[model samples]
Target: MAPTTLVLNAGSSSIKFALYRAGDDVSLALRYKGKLDHHAGDVHFRITDAAGRELTAPDAHGHADDPTSALLERLEPLLGDDDIVEVGHRVVHGGPDFVEPVQVDDAILRRLDALSPLAPLHQQIGLAAIRTIMRTRPALRQIACFDTAFHHDMPPVYRNFALPDLGADIRRYGFHGLSFAYIASRLDAHQRRTVVAHLGSGASVCALLDGRSINTSMSFTPLDGLMMATRSGAIDPALVLYLQRTREMCIEAVENLLYHRSGLLGVSGSSADMRTLIGERNAGARQAVAQFCARAAEHMASMMTALRGCDAIVFTGGIGENSPEIRASICDHLAWLGLRLDPVLNASGAGVITCDRSEIVARVIETNEELVIAREVRRLTQSRH
Candidate 1:
């Protein structure tokens, strides 16, 4: 039978699963991709084969309360022993220790549970999914893939908080590692010391040096760094304190505003979706785009400090890959650094959409994080005794 690896990305309200087959020469390629969305109107799931051909049409269940269980139940009919061999899980926070893929066990589960506070939305869901899997199959070969692993190479100078090391914590550990790592691994073939703009609704940048993470835009948590769809991005903690002192606002409320109600949507008073905002060109829409471009360039400068300079700037994610307007706006500010986005190529969906002669190159490239996770699962599972 062909070897198969299953990769799971467990989010707060969704669980995305992908099955990949490790080819005869050990090349990992996706076989099936699907997702289960919960807490919505109705629990719905759909799966597609490697070619994205629908393997199963949309299936619905009326108000499935548990997302993990909902995902598991819907997935049961679609998978069999011949379909899945090993599993890879996306764990958001690895704290200070788990910087590499490791076999999941009791100690790892305990640590993941403890780190739930660091990534309240993601980690809890990851643990919940892991628990559900454990209950469903007690002896499955599973591995924990760390989102912080790629940033583990950051120097002490870059990682430290400068305020007395507090119990090996309070240090900066970047997120979106699996996505960033997939990009970083492929960057060397494209350019040296490249800056990757992962501009989704939730966005961040990673500066790659020689195919390793030198610096990244996001710091400590996803809420820090650049302006996102809803995240405030690198706001002054003093503002929260002031709100608490002057208005008696609680921590949860402040967090909710900063993490959920701010950014493009907050300022736009319209929508977080960039394409929608860009279309309207309203005062709020213009402001949101301007703020996004400004903050992106600002953080790019910081990441450059780690690499002295960059050879290229690669754009990925939903907005980064599709929105030519945002790409143009960002490149406008980067002109001083010699980045000139080729208008014809940028609009045409060409992969390397940068002016050939431009010194600081800019291009768009779609990322495949599930394939990366599948590779890790294959590697770890193959090593098992």
Candidate 2:
């Protein structure tokens, strides 16, 4: 039986997992990938092989009482004879301390749990998964790959706010580091000074200089950046104060408003999914789409300023890779930067979408955060031997 590594990316509603064949060497090959979703109080489990063929039945269900246990039970039969030697997790926040992947222990778990307040939507979910695995499979080794580790070395100018020294804890710690790191690895050597727009439900723009993050749109938390599907994104600090003072909204209520109730859903008054908003003709939907594109373009431009100039603009993430219309709309706003899209190539939805004469090249590259996690896990685990 070959050794395997399991990578888990836990979100607010689901835990996406991938199993990889971990050889004695550095290279890892994917075996299976799937999600454990919690919807309407029911747990659903699904799995697919590396070839994208469904391995589990459509109606496969998980235990509502213990979703993690259900996930293990379902995975057991599929494992055949392969043994899962180590598990890697996508933890959203590493704060100021962790700049690289690290093994998780009780002390490290406590430290991660303390960071939950900073990444309210993701930190807790990831920690819960880690704790569950530790309890159910106590002997199995686990490692944490942080989402903020990529931008941990970003210049202080981009990392600090205007406020007085509030200590090391309160600084601009960017999210989506795993995605950015993967995108960087895929870029051409000549594509230095690139601005990558990771547009999805949780979106952000990042500036890469020589394949390393120099600046990013998110600051301190995921809430500060381009407007996302359900997040308000970069709002004026005074507006938060105003809401609390005159509106008399409590801290929890205000948090709920910005993190869950705002952005596309709040503006459109219906759905948060970009695909849904794109097909609708309602005025609210139209406005929401327009606003999302505009705000995304604006943030991309901001990342360009940090790079002094942009050599290329790469789009990744769900909305960035799939939606040609949205990509065209965003490029239309960036025309001033000498970015001209090849309509035919843009429609193809992959590869270079920029015209031959365009000053700035634009391309669509699908990101693989799970693979990044698996690679890190392999590296850390191998180093011990």
Instruction: Using TM-score, give the best candidate's number.
Output: 2
TM-score, one value per model: 0.93, 0.97
Candidate 2 CA-lDDT value? 0.92
Per-residue CA lDDT of model 1 for 289-337, tens digit only, reads: 8999889888886777788988888888888889888888888888888
- Give the range of the ten consecutive residues with the poorest summed lDDT in model 1: 74-83
Return the top candidate by lDDT: 2
User: What would you estimate as the lDDT of candidate 1?
Assistant: 0.80
What would the per-residue lDDT of candidate 2 be over residues 1-385, giving only the tens digit for each residue? 9999999988777778899998879899899998888776688877899999987565446466566667777777778899988999999999999999999999999999999889999998888888998998998899999999999989999988999998998899998999999999999999889999999999999999999999999989999989999999999999989999999999999999999999999999999999999999999999999999999999999999999999999999989999999999999999998999999999998699998999999999998999999999999988888
In model 1, which runs have C-alpha deviations exceeding 4 angstroms?
23-26, 56-58, 70-81
lDDT of candidate 2 at residue 385, scale 0 to 100: 89
Name the TM-score of candidate 1.
0.93
For model 2 the local lDDT of residue 344 reads: 96
